[model samples]
Target: MAGDRGAVRRARDWTRDWGRIWGGAWHRGDGTILAALLAAWVLGVSVWPLARLFLEALAPGADGVPLGLMAEVLEARSTGRAFRNTLAASAGSVVIATVLGTVLAFATGLLRLRGRVAMTFLILSPLLIPSQTMALAWIELSGSNSPVLRPLGLAPPPGTTNPIYSGGGIALLMGIEHMPLVFIALRAALATLPADLVEAARIAGAGRLRILTRIILPLALPSALAGAILAFAAAVGNFGVPALLGIPGRFPMLTTLIYQRLNGFGPSVAGQVAVLALILVALALGALGLRALVLSRLSVPLGRGAALRPLDPGRARLPLEAAIWAVLAVIAILPMLALVATALSPALGVALSASTATTANFHEVLANPTIRRAFANSLLLSALAALVCTLVALPFAWLKVSARAPLIRLLDWLVDGPWVVPGTVVALAMILAFLPPLPLVGSLYGTFAILLLAYLARFLPLVLRPVVAGAEALEPAQDEAARIVGAGPLRRILFVLAPALLPAAMAGALILMMTAVNELTLSALLWSSGNETLGVMVFALQYEGNSTAAAATSVLSLLMVLALALALDAMRRWLPPGTLPWRD
Candidate 1:
């Protein structure tokens, strides 16, 4: 019986070795083909447009000098004004974001509070809320008829000037909108604190404030600044806030100016607008580069240690928790309540009441053919983008994990370029790339194809990131065994690789869908007649002076977003840890 068992084992080993010899080359060929296809798609979809945008901005002058278009744009007073406005607003907002975000991060990251998960979710609410929706909520909050403020007698009179329509207002609101950037960064920095350094500080006769000021702040400053820079970049790219507030406020910004120019004159002014787009991209990139410099220079190397323990504030705990919760309610909960109230009001300036409030605004918005179409379009577009991104991300991640495809590795950096820059810049690049007719795919301009291509370029990285993470976590033995059993690449991927990676891919797709559905920046530029999206619909309704209708539309969009988020949260048990973002 022992001899027979040995013979059977030897026979199995010989079969496996034979299978591996035959299948390895076939698998390599399959990966190469898939990699080549993915490379072409990325190059055409993403790289070409950015290159063309730069070239358009560098159009030669009659005197044969390059960058003539850029020079002309810079000479314009409007350009200068917009540039000044953007800088001032971004800088001011960064200050607010840094202060608020740092306080929140320190509170939540250091102290063990009741309902930490709930508090953290509320703190990061702005990131999930669309910029237009956030702006609308604030507009409702400070309005004369605001439900929250009116009851407290804090709202201004009906005809009094609104405060959320100035440079300071823009800064204040944008600061709140981007606070999560700083919160996330500093939270991560705090989590990695060296236990020894903190203990040493405590033993050296240092009080809470002193340890925080001397040790914690010093160690956390780089992360704080990096988050501030990121917030600044996000503020500069923000169109929804500036468009809703700044346009009416008569404060020009590069993003709004570009939108106005292109919308008014069509693509005829694209060359002129390209220069502004280039500036926006430059500012974002320059800030990111500065962030890299700060992280490299200011970051302190620390030995690996246990995670920092929660601070025992003793008597201060309840008050501290109360304060944090209060601020969160003001920033996160109030605006949403205000928006719902406005939507329920019979008229724009009417006070919401039990008897007076009605569903007329919602009924009208839902009944309108245009808004209904916009909803359908957004749903379809987001779904398609999510579907396509998941499909492409799979092979891209598969090839990326192996060392065989160096180009895949290099292109991985390129993939990040689109996501890192502002959405307005990516939209402009798309217009430049496909506005003109192409072979067999002529003139994607004024069509859904352009939006699809732009979204693929812009959002593919969202899915790719998770898929890559999932791929890295996969057991190598399964893949090796598959290969040894005579499985080809496609078969292995279908049978062995995809099942393990789908949950992560789906999590990412859910993100992409939620984001793309409520997106304003890309849709603002790329959307055409009959292609109006949810963001554009809200902007249009508000621009048309239908405040109640806009409020209703915004409320609906917010519901859709929240629904998607909750769905993902419900699936957290099935998903990989840290993928859902809210809890683990």
Candidate 2:
């Protein structure tokens, strides 16, 4: 009887301890609640789905933990060809992008060139345009019945097929699409170049070419390598370019191959296709790892000094400026003009003469119920995602800066997993995780919630990064003062901290909204009937041979992007440096 009483006493003590722990978790000063939310989001949106995909690939048909499926996938002829094609196209595009981007960066960042700001905007316009739209514009510009070419009597022969429907064409367009990444990286590096070093070299009688080759190139090499790796990763994961250009030309990359298999054979082949997704992930990760290694070994530390002054081109400035304009014309203006022409054409394949030009395509798309629904849906999703992500980012950023919890730091790292992983992989994981009825939610597979959840997961990092920057720059004295005045943690955050971080949060939300509105890859797999996004509708119209409608939709989408960019540009005076890409 005494021993039983002792056991009961121990049980009571354990219950009291548990209650204390639970109470601490609910306390406001500690970041326990915020940490828990972040953990839940990371697991539900990223970790769970990725783990399921890996498991499905490795253990198909209940055969537990075997390499047989992976080996078979690797050995398949189709897999081999697609892998090679992906590597080749990625490498080719990286080379092209690096060259073009480096030249543009030097001219705009280092040279005393005319209209540099406008040129920078034009050069980066591809980042605003969707990959599929870029591919479509190129197609319209190149085909035998090309509106731009046909008007000048320079159209290719009738029997000649569009050259853009080939692997080389995919590489070309992908390079153009990703050039901005390299340009931005190199331009940033150039902005940090020390004027003292360049001036000393010039004083030593070094010529322009000598200083450029010996001094500038070496210092910029690390950024160039980093940019090359980014371009390569983007190329490997790109679906729109491969889908629009490669499939028709019989050149399939891993992304497109996965789409084709799952789409054609349904979920029955999911495990098999997941093997392909794994390969893509491996390739992208490998490139990123290489980038890290190279940067670690090759990075040059610069002394603090004034920035390098722009160099004059003397008598050559006019020709160089003309060359820059011509390149921009080919990459930006021509394709846009072709898209406009196509949108104005009476029908597909019609010549864009004065008589054939009309606003019928734009009017028709605007009036269509389906198109209107898609626009509304896209706008709503993008806006909600931006607002929600911004809200969540605030507390998380606070936790990251103020909390010393190991779990908070770990969660911070894990949040980037969804952003870095290919969208195809993310979509596949989402399908695998949510295809069945969720506990209280029922099936989310066909609902708009799935898309919203994916967007939140994919874009949370965008909002988090900027807010963290703002939080890190903040002085902790104010919060401490508020606390000493008897203000609670919640009151301090709401009244003291929120106002300071509002601008950065707003900027991040604007960027997220623009990015998500025309997003393709995530929506490509997640979208269903009556739940179409602008990207899906554009792809569908093009696939159905309604090029005119597709062009009109693309034009409208581009206009929105430009309008947002302009709005941001107008507000750049009040924003911090580096907040707006075009402004920087």
TM-score of each: 0.93, 0.94
Clashes of 1: 0
Q: What C-alpha lDDT do the candidate models reach, one value each? A: 0.88, 0.86
* Off by more than 4 A, model 2: 1-28, 60-65
> Best lDDT goes to which candidate?
1
Candidate 2: which pairs clash? none
Report the lDDT tens digits of candidate 1 across residue range 356-401.
Answer: 8999999999999999999999999999999999988887777777
Residue 212: error of model 1 in Å?
A: 2.0
What's the distance in Å from true for residue 63, model 1?
Answer: 5.7
Evaluated against the true structure, the overall lDDT of model 2 is 0.86
Question: Candidate 2, which ten residues in sequence have the lowest lDDT sum?
Answer: 59-68
